[model samples]
Target: MSRRCELTGKGVMVGNNVSHANNKTKRRFLPNLNDVSLMSDTLGRTFQLRISASALRTVDHRGGLDAFLAKAKDAELSPRALKIKRDIAKAQAATAA
Candidate 1:
């Protein structure tokens, strides 16, 4: 697909590469993305996602995928991620109800 993080919404950033001669060239800084399968405690399933390294660290720090998704804003999540988030929410609600 695209060069973007499915979790953190990290994408390519554009900047100028400056040379010693004061010449500037366009450059792109891409996020460190990796394909990972994260286990969701609520859904009890493993979901594969493409996410940035930093986002993966944050997920670990936050405890797990479920916890991270709970804290993540809807605006930042991709359509696929958002669907997963909704599924988790529905599962949790059903269990609680």
Candidate 2:
């Protein structure tokens, strides 16, 4: 699988690694990604996602998966996450109506 966070779209960053001799080599700063299961209250389901550590923390801080997705931008979400977001919205709307 690609090294990208499915939630926040965090990806590898390019940088230079400098040595003591002033030599620089290209390096990649990869985001710390983990496979996590987050529960969505609106959909009443758990989603398995590959996300960055910071994004995981943000999810918890925002209350849960549903809350985080509500605040997340569509451009930053993966296709799977975008689908889940739509499903959650539909479920919540169904409950409201």
Per-residue lDDT of candidate 1, residues 21-77 (tens digit): 999999999889999999999988899999999999999999999989999999889
- TM-score, structure 2 vs. true: 0.97
Clashes of each: 0, 0
Candidate 2 local lDDT, 1-97, one digit each (tens): 9999999999999999999999999999989999999998887778899999999999999998999999999999999999999999999899999
Q: What is the TM-score of each candidate against the true structure?
A: 0.97, 0.97
Segments in model 2 whose C-alpha atoms lie over 4 Å from true places: none
* lDDT, candidate 2, at 28: 94
Question: What is the Å distance of residue 23 in model 1 from its true position?
Answer: 0.6
Worst 10 residues of 1 by lDDT: 1-10
lDDT of 1: 0.94
- Residue 79's lDDT in candidate 1: 97
Q: What are the Cα lDDT values of the candidates?
A: 0.94, 0.94
